[model samples]
Target: MSTSTSSTTPLLSLRGINKSFGAVHVLKGVDLDVWPGKVTALVGDNGAGKSTLIKGIAGIYSFDSGSYSFEGQQVEVTNPKQANALGIEVVYQDLALCDNLDVVQNLYLGREATSGVILDETTMERKATETLKGLSVRTLKSVRMKVSSLSGGQRQTVAIARAVLWNSKLVILDEPTAALGVAQTEQVLQLVRRLADAGLAVILISHNMNDVIRVADNVAALYLGQMAAQVPSESLSHGQIVELITAGRSGDLGLKAPDKEVVA
Candidate 1:
């Protein structure tokens, strides 16, 4: 994957974030930073609060307590619309495209361009074509093809392209390569790299360690609800990442043992 030094300023920064459901607290003082032109992988075991945290960031659920800042400006995100208006876009694992709709139609599903009182197919198609081109995506045969007929990789590309078409600054992809074959997975991964290369802050949520290591610039491990560490991907081996996820710390981050071992 192509890489650049992490920027001094993060495109999105969350400090001391918290979330809960009734009596259950899911997130505990989580801190994360996503820099432009880089992919930050969010990894944790099941029920480790990864999903809950992203939902809070996507504005599907409001964080109980935290400071959310975008490009250095503090702000509050209470709803999905607000997040979108602020250039935050999330493409979930489901790929939420209408099977019956073609790429062009799916791309402009709710927010179609209109001229006077008629749907402007020409302009919308042009925009979709340009967006895909801008991302250097060329896997689709035609933009008019039905989504159901596209391959897994092609479908993933369409969802990402749709998000980018809306002038998104931050793109959150949830398990983007899940259920894809090796070749398809590679195609999608390349697209992901291009997203960051194009200068968009990409938050990648994946369980595949190889994929994360290959494409991510940084990895943030969450054990339970707390951040175990947010370190450079190149600095960690797979074992170290696993240790952090399971034990909450590894290497120097882990607590030191006493000089003497206790006998049972």
Candidate 2:
């Protein structure tokens, strides 16, 4: 789970990112860095601003203030299309697969290839097969199988494959293993690791500490609306990560405590 070298610039970097909804502040000067060929797990309790920060990264929501830099260049991503153009993709928790459609159909749902006036079924199927094979996915029996019939892990696999099919560089996953059995969870976690191994910068959003410890190269903990800490996963124990998530600090590794007022 070693990350890219320190001298390598991050694929995505956000500094002093701030966002709000009307009167409520959702993100407060949060900072995050996503390195190529590594998985950075985004961990936080509910209402910790993880979703807001990710949405900002995906261009689903624009940050009110912050620096959005991709590949060391500053840029403005105002919408999802912009994010996609910059090789960023997000696989939300819902999976977003069309159950009635086959695997190839789901993979090329919106951006289907065409031959003259007809759909290029042959090419699409071939590409789908290749993408799955490239990821070392072996559980799927056929790309023609309907998504509704596939197991939970297989469906997740399809979603992940679809994300990378567009040549995405940064892939963000939200609760990918939620509601899955132990075996299925392991399957998904392995796929997640493979993504980073293939030189893609991956952002994994999950509450499961074990999964984070198992696959993440770096752990980014969000507390309330602030970034608690971002450190190498191997450097922190499970309990230390839990403390950062819950209290915004694990000893000196996270946010410092505010000054106490004098009562005298």
Candidate 3:
């Protein structure tokens, strides 16, 4: 739970990012930094602009204004392809796997290896097996099994492994444990920690406070489309995180709190 990135430059930094839909403003001067080898949890209530912020990063929608810097260099990511080209991968809430497809098929769905106009099934299967093995994933019975027969945790693992197999620098997981049971959630959370341990920046978007507190190194709360605060998870209590999510700041944060309120 102790995530210290001292003396290390952030791998991804967003400065004053603004997004709007016609007359509706979604993000307002949002600023955030993601360090390699750490997990930054993005939490917010419904309509707090968490989704909008992530979409902008995912290149689903272009931000009306603001700056995006990856590895301290300014860049424009106009589409998911651009994001992927920059070593950014987003594993959405749905997991987006073809249920009927086997593990190797899902892993190499679109980017399968080919040999003289023929699908290289042997190579793809070997790569899939190696990828899972590299992640230290041992619970899977077989990488050739159809996704439909895998448990929720195994599916999540496969999705994450696929992202990592591409040499991704940053992996954004949206609600990874949302539909999973307790043990399954624990399994996915362990993989999340392993991701950071392997030196990849991880942005975990989840509404579950317990999971966030348990796995996140740093927690960034989004309030009304703005970044309320980004602090070490160990420095915040569950109630304080909820307070920031709901009110943009913790009301009980005496001297540490901002001085916007005057004591009568």
Candidate 4:
């Protein structure tokens, strides 16, 4: 399955991916390349296997076939720890913050600083402040503010800031703005664009077409566990994308619509 992937080596590539569970084939011969400094939006309906494919890439599930490559080298990422070490971060909609804990504490949860076994709170807090400032995050009142006091956008910002602080190579966002208002959604989208501008590969999974069209540089649609379409966002119209997602293939893809007679 040749795609729009460039001739230049990709930062991350998945080739010949196949996954199944008790006779249910989830993915078949999937190929995708995520280059640095681009947003690849993955879109699909409910149960279209988008989440499953992500799990496979994130190392939650081992696939029966396919090779996952990073920086032109083939590697097996078998678990979350390996992915994290490789600078791959997945930010789900939940944002995964501790409401009771302050921003700094949440950011450095298990990975805390220590001075002779005692946590170096002062240093960590100071570093956290620097990170937030680097991202130009303004809504955050203080590094010591409890997450429970933060708004939806603030929580999302913290999650992304954590990824940026870790120098994430590939950041996967799952429905980043599903629960946010227009302003908050814009905030997340700007953060996403910033990540790409800084040369990080971003894979965004969203059901909202508007969000996808607005933030994506390229779009990949999954239909019924099959990668139905892979096209550059600029080359496609919204109607064409919708057709590709709802149907197996769109007219622009040169595949005949289901049960439709091919024109002679």
Query: Against the true structure, whose lDDT is highest?
Result: 2
Per-candidate Cα lDDT values, in order, are 0.91, 0.94, 0.89, 0.84
How would the candidate models be sorted by TM-score, starting from the highest? 2, 1, 3, 4
For candidate 4, the 10 contiguous residues with the lowest summed lDDT are 1-10
TM-score of 2: 0.98
Alpha-carbon runs more than 4 Å astray in model 4: 1-7, 254-264
Q: Residues 1-264, candidate 1: write the lDDT tens digits.
A: 665554679999999999989999899899999999999999999988999999988899999998999989999999999999989999999989999999999999999999999999999999999998888888888889999899999999999998999999999999999999999999999999999988899999999998999899999999889888999898999999888888888978632333696799
- List, in order, the clash count of every candidate structure: 0, 0, 0, 0
Per-residue alpha-carbon lDDT of candidate 3 for residues 148-218, written as tens digits (9 for 90 to 100) = 99999999999998898898999999999999999999889989988888789999999999999999988
Best by TM-score: 2
TM-score result, candidate 1: 0.95
Question: What does the lDDT come to for candidate 2?
Answer: 0.94
Compute the lDDT for candidate 3. 0.89
- Two-way lDDT contest, 2 vs 4, winner: 2
Off by over 4 Å in 2: 2-7
RMSD for all candidates, in order, please. 2.3, 1.3, 2.8, 3.9
